[model samples]
Target chain A: MQDQLKLQRAALADFGLFAFRCDDVDELLHRATELVSEALDVPLVKVLEHWPDRGEMLIRAGVNWQPGVVGHETFGDDVRSPGGYALRCDEPVVSPDLDVENRFEMPEVLRRHGVRSMVNVVIAGEGPAYGVLEVDAQQPRGFTEDDVAFLRSYANLLAAAIERVRVHEELRRSAREQGILARELGHRVRNLLSLVRALASRTSAQGRTAEEFRTAFIDRLQALSTAESLVFESNRERTDPLVLAEEVLAPHRQEDAGSISIEGSSVDLSARQARMFGLALHELATNAAKYGALSVAGGKVSLGWDLEAQKGARKRLSMTWQESDGPEITPPQLKGFGTRLLEDVVARELNGEAKLAYRAQGLNYTLSFTVDG
Target chain B: MIDNKDGNLSGRRVLVVEDEHLIAMDVQDILEGWGCTVMGPVASAAAALELIEGDLPDAAVLDVNLNGGTSEPVAEALRNGKCPFLVMTAYNASHLFGALAGAPLLNKPVDETKLRQELSALLADTASDRCSGT
Candidate 1:
């Protein structure tokens, strides 16, 4: 009895150190069953996890058991097994004999292995009992109450280790997600700073007077800011060309949707293309409202597009804008910010050409660009 | 502040390669104000290269991201033409052109006075490089 007590003490100490070194739960459980087998001088030791939904306990890890018994085996939690009794009582169960056991029947596999005695301890976990840890012997023998107590402590250590690994994995996943979000924020801020710097210098040059400069700069900045808000809020890298036109013309068409018309096939513009075209549409709408069709009571603007061609992997889109019933129009004296933006920046951004004209009747515009379909 | 031997930037052709029109126009305005003749304000590297073959200018200004990519090909053409050029870019990085290491760099929203000074230095360097036969 004294020797058995000393052996059990050493087993608990060794397992306590083992738990600290285990990298994962599977390794912890497998090593634990091996430790139980060595410390108790038993032939069979197994850890079975509860699967209440399946109404069974599965052999998660074991020692001195057949290859088919570990991992690929399960047994019911009915009243016949020691594991079942432990779970039903939520405590340890000791069955020193199977030959004359009246309450539980001996399983064929255990009977085949000449097992006549068994002791099981419940493995306590977060919300419920995780499973049972059992030791088997071929001969019926005395199983002290102290031995059941020792097994219960070992099972507790296993549950704690599993929970530790799960929490670690969760933390690491959340940290990685935060890192990606921070990088995207930094990239956007840098781009915006560069954009404003370029805008200020160019807009100031367009101003002949300080007042003219303020008006042009403020209007341009407002347009860029609004477009940026719409693009980011959509949370999509590409924007629909038709939606862009409607949004840029929203203020002009307020309570007068009939004054402006938009028609186009479904086309998604790339991020760079979207920003450039969004700004272009803003300028066009602003011009029409100030001097073209949208300026007069009877004038109206119509925008339209068509798929010009689809060559294998590339698609070309052609668009047009015209004003009708506006007062007589004439070409501007010189190229201003609007004219330069339409004919130069917009054309360059789309890798296409833009034709802008001021006929006696109205302003006529045509543009075309190609994109991957 | 090196003066054009002719006492004016007039008659000295300046090639301009920039993707953004308004910014390009700013550069064109500055060059024209200095009395220099502005060549193509071409918006792409390919177009800039074509212009270089037709008539290489005395100097050029380039943007790093032309059509969303580096303008190294146009830089190469400018180098081969023995035409001095400086980059005015929004990007602050060395990888813009790893091979074009020694060329001058100017930042976006260019300080007009500094742009002219850098252009003079680049032009002078190109002239000396030719005189030395490198």
Candidate 2:
């Protein structure tokens, strides 16, 4: 018996070395059961993994079990089963005789294998119990205190190994996700650079002085920058259109407090949508201050939006920019940068349509675009 | 500030496929400045394909990523119609897969001079191919 205990200690040391270095959890669990079975001189051994979501313990790994019993078996997590009882009590449980034992229900597979006795210990980790480890013997015998001590040590090693593997996998996944996000951010940065280049080139210099050109270009860039920051500051994949409007129009709002009104329900817009819409709003406000409504006292600008349900998880957003009480407006002979941007560029970008009506009272602009919810 | 020295692309029709409005507008402006009659600067693969079916352009400029999906279908359609197209993208070469592989690639914020030169070369090559009848 002293020699047998020495052999068990050697097996435990051998398994401790293997478990710490092994990366695969499956191999670790299977090797543990095999080592314990050999050390204890038991024919049947298994590891039941606790699946909290399923509320059951799965036979994850085992040694010397029946052909179909190892991986294809499950047991209730409740205290009715021997393994469950050990897990609940946080102590080792020993059934010296199963046929005469009325404390726990006998498992069908153990009975089939003629299991007369078994010992189980909880495989516990720092967070929660991993599961239960059990060894079964064909002949009825009391499990010695030394046997329980060996099993407890083996279970503690298994739990530590399991946790190590889980943490390693989490680290690997987080690194991969960060790599993807970095690549995506790089792509977006390049795209934004391209957009700024486009805006600089498209900001026309047909009839304006260099200083005028600078102000116009800077204002447009400021609008784009404001939109980009709003999208980033929110840290959301999508941005709120009303908040976007409010932010973009804040500069124009101070001089005319009640002159500008934005009325819209909460709706989400893609980053791209918000930027373009913000630029359009800037142009509209600039035009209003220069020629249309916000130029004079008592001139009013109201931006209203409505959402209508469309087929297949899409919604249609219709926004109207109305200017009133300014000057008797006459349509300009030549289309300006703002006119072309609103009519063609903004409409095409949103996959929508925009109409500008140079009414005698004020400029009425309406645009409709699709939103993916 | 694009220099149109030769005026070679006097009447060539080039279809522009890009999702970003500013980029699309700039491309249109540049191509038109070169005297090319630019076709729809379509924002999606479906729209580009429909435009191709309607009237095949002389050549095409395709952005690899369109909104949430890739432009492989548009590339395939352009290939089937024997239409030459160059990819302008912010992504790397690996992003171009299957039908899009090995096509001419011009990185985003494309140099207007290089774009003009590449288009001229593509047209020159196609003109020679027609002459060779291969």
lDDT of each: 0.77, 0.87
Model 1 misplaced stretches (Cα beyond 4 Å): A1-144, A255-258, A264-270, A306-317, A370-373, B1-134
User: Over the stretch A288-307, how does candidate 2's per-residue lDDT look in tens digits?
Assistant: 99998888999999999999
Quote the lDDT for A253 in model 1. 84
Give each prediction's root-mean-square deviation over alpha carbons: 6.6, 3.8
DockQ, per model, reads 0.24, 0.74
- DockQ of candidate 2 against the true complex: 0.74
Q: Which lDDT value does model 1 have at A354?
A: 90
Candidate 2 residue pairs in clash (backbone atoms < 3 Å): none
lDDT of candidate 1 at residue B37, scale 0 to 100:
82
lDDT of 1 at A344: 78
Candidate with best TM-score: 2
For candidate 1, the share of real interface contacts preserved is 0.25
Q: Is the docking of candidate 1 incorrect, acceptable, medium or high quality?
A: acceptable
Q: Give the per-residue lDDT digits (tens) of candidate 1, residues A1-373.
A: 7887788788888888887777677788898998888878898999989898998989999999977888977879876776878888887778888776676777777887789899888887677778889899999967888888778887888777766766776888899989878766664564565566556766645437888777666776776676676667676666677777777667778968888888998776776677667777777777888888888897988888887657886778788888889988878888776787888777876788898988776888888888665
